[model samples]
Target: MSKNKAKKEATEKEYRKPLIKRRKPNRSIAGDIALYLFLTLVAFVMAFPIIYAVSSALKPLDELFKFPPTIFAQHPTTDNFSDLFITMGKSWVTFSRYLFNTVFITAVGTAGHLIIASMGAFVLAKYEFPGAQGFFKVVTVAMMFTGYATAIPNYIILNKLGWIDTYWAIIIPAFASPMGFFLMKQFMEGLPTSLIEAAKIDGANEWKVFSGIVMPNVKPAWMTLIIFSVQALWNNKASTYIYSEERKTLVYALQQIQAGGIARTGQGAAVLVVVMIVPIIIFVFSESQILETMASSGLKD
Candidate 1:
């Protein structure tokens, strides 16, 4: 009887194993479904504005001000875009020039930030110089201050240097960024010290070690800095560019479209849509690569 009881208990335990395994899989599937639903909702919220802006830009003048707000334009026209170029039968040649100016400023500013920030961060992370920790602490504190607070001082300095209304006014001030330095420093700190030591053992100078070994390893951080710099310069508004009428960015140009009153509403929307496309395209193409590289680097580390 005791042997039969033991056999029965063994059979019951065997049946319970399958039930436990099935419960785990069911719970995992439910969790995955919940996460997907949450992500889908968030995506829609973010995409709605971009979709609306494009639709508004394409809407005909008659349908632009409709009461309920039409989600789709019945008649799309390119007339608004054409009007931006033509002013009283003669082309406003300055439009393209201003666009190029913005591009140049953004490009130079982004590159400068990447090089300077990465180098500074590498030094702070690897070197054991005196006052290093204190200096880094100061940088962290400086980052907490908004750039707008220094606009007046920046403008005055630029004015002293006769840089107002020139590309220097925009580009020069952007190079001194504390946030980029901080981010790069944090990333550099996480790099394996053995790599730096190995490079030095081979008689590589400090610059060689930095460029040949450290920079390559921190590609993700570098890409992140590029994205940040691009976005910041692209959206900058609180500089002399705000005060100077002749030297206006694409953002300022878009505002001018509204100066003609309510009849030109469609044109204003078109100008906004055109200006927005470049940044959106850049963000879309770079964001995925940046995220993937960062994820892989983190996993490897």
Candidate 2:
């Protein structure tokens, strides 16, 4: 019996030996170190501009163009920001108004795009109506056309509607986003039909099914759409809300700083840093929770 037990142990050890030998314990550690090194390098590369901007913004005016280019401010101060807000006076008030205008338009535009695009995509993906394919083809074609090509027509339409120099000129044109519809439609096609069918059998109407069943299942896609839409509109410089000085976006505001005079170079840097960093920080923090959920949820259907 003791001999049999010893033989069994030897057999088990023999079986386990191959797995142990095949396992490269240090390989995983090496891979992890390599990945971290690459990411650190990428982080530094991406962060350098932001770091430089912040340093420039904080540096004293005399040190702004000091030779050799300091990575850190020699003497940090908020004088640039203060001058931007206080010395500019009336221009500062206009800037604040434009900032608020941009925020409102972007938020509303993003929400509207998500709702309208999702609904349109749902119909296109699920229902087989007359000319459905043709309609989708038209949407695809529209997406292929650059916004610049339609800028003249859009300007004409806005002018015809007397929307020039108003918030509507900015917010209204953004409502019908072809790319957004296409993205939603593609995402919707991946969802299981059985979910919609089950909801229908349970006496849920199309609206109820779409809002409850469809939206919940595609949270990741929706979040992605929201992020993209926000970024696009927030950074937009074209159209310029009818080119009015008072009704410009943050981008236009920064442009004004340069147009006013290149002498305000440090102030321009401060404004640019503030405008760019604020949206990026907001987007990162807001989307982080959604991204965590998306990661844990896995890509399974």
Candidate 3:
């Protein structure tokens, strides 16, 4: 009797309908067209500068100097890029050396910032200790000030430490930047305490919990942080701290070409495109992760 009742209830349950039917949004053809047009306009506006830079880089000297300057080059050529290479080849220091300095500084600074910021954020987010809140408050306050505001203090400190004219002058300062710390801590706050506790219960040590558990979950935050750190360090000229020509960056070398009074105009245009390339590529690949991090950064259990 009980078996028959159970089978009958199961049959009845199989045919039950959902209580609430999902409704499609009401459609408006005119509104849809208008919305699409607006989005297209905005995207073009945002992308125009990048397009213009590429166009300018391809333009010949005559076209570049034309009275009514065009957005797109009529006769696109690679002469500008060729000239840039030739000019770089003629420099006192090899272009490759300047490139090495920039790449080395940017890579070291970005990696250091990522590791230090993540560790600091992990401690602040997962553990409670004396002066933690106060320290974070200091970090928040530090974020409010721009690099220009702190330049003098940085120079003085670096000078005192005798790091002036060295890579440490720039790389060390980048590691202490508060932007990554603030961002990572906020995003990590949304991670559940119980998940971390569970790892601990399994006999995972602090380093294991942080490396195996915490870091994997905060991918978006750190990826976005990489973009910011790379952009800053890659573009930095460090003119004030490092006076050595060999120690100067690619940007500083390119800026000399740019200031060469009308003769290197095309090469200068190519320089702009080259400088923009790395950061743009990095951002494009990580854009989705960044968007996810931004959207869910504030949500917590």
Candidate 4:
């Protein structure tokens, strides 16, 4: 009867315990407050430029050149944006055409770069082959040179291939960009080889292993690569190669307005906002994916 009573008491104690235990913070409340204050200051500093740009875009011509440029507009107006649209309406090439060209190029180029780079990175990271190390070394060296350094060579090759006036000149080069491939390869190296081998042991083919297993595991890396690729392609003017007015990007159109001297100063500020907004939006939306760690931890035994 005593043993039975003891068992009943133990059961009652277990039921009384909380299901979830909360961890105690290592830092005191004062420390946490100080840390948050410092972070807020850093964030404000970084966001200052973007805030200033928006303010400038809203400022009228007179306020824009005021002594000691202000971070916020005194009397904000949409005149700059309205004037920008009016000026764009005067261009021979329709604004929609420029928008379409940019969207198409950016979308196609980013997609192509992601797929091709991911595949190449998969091969380099997972498989061993003759000259693999040497090939990766070449890619690492290639990344050191800026696009300006390779501009002439790219033009010459495109000219030979009769792609000078065509979209292929830009899109093709983007597919072969070294940055995405390098990033993906580095990220993929951290993925567990055992997970891949397990997939293979289940009779999965190479493509299945790559598309199903490897790609999903390296989500953060590719999302970052997308941001880089989009930023590069979105800002590209293609002036050196693409001569046709109809083939020009939205950036080229805005740049033309920006060069209209002091008369178009307000419009020029608006142009800066328009050009930068798209990439900023893309980055904001994908930031979570970029920061997320690989999902391999849960899959482990």
Which candidate number maximizes TM-score? 3
Ordered list by lDDT, greatest first: 3, 4, 2, 1
* Candidate 1 lDDT over residue span 60-83, tens digit each: 777888989988777887767777
lDDT of 2 by residue, 1-301 (tens): 9999999999999999988967865568679899999999999999999899899999888888789889999899999998887544666446677677678778988898889889988999898999988888888889778888988888888889999888788777777888777777877787899999999999999999999999888776677677767777887764544566566776767767757666787898788786777567756766864464344332222
Taking the tens digit of each residue's C-alpha lDDT, what string does model 4 give over 1-301? Answer: 9999999999987876643232544657899899999999999999998898899999988999999988899999999998887777778998778888888899899999999999998999889999898898888889889989988888899999999988888898999899778778877888889999999999999999999999888878877889989999999988888889999888998899899988888998898898899889988988876665223212221
Segments of candidate 2 deviating more than 4 angstroms: 1-46, 238-244, 286-301
> How much is 39 displaced in model 2, in angstroms?
7.0
Off by over 4 Å in 4: 1-47, 65-69, 291-301
TM match of model 1 to true structure: 0.78
Query: Residue 293 in candidate 3 has what lDDT?
Result: 66
Clash totals for all models, in order? 0, 0, 0, 0
lDDT of 2 at 81: 90
| Predictions in order: lDDT | 0.77, 0.79, 0.89, 0.87
TM-scores for all predictions: 0.78, 0.77, 0.86, 0.80
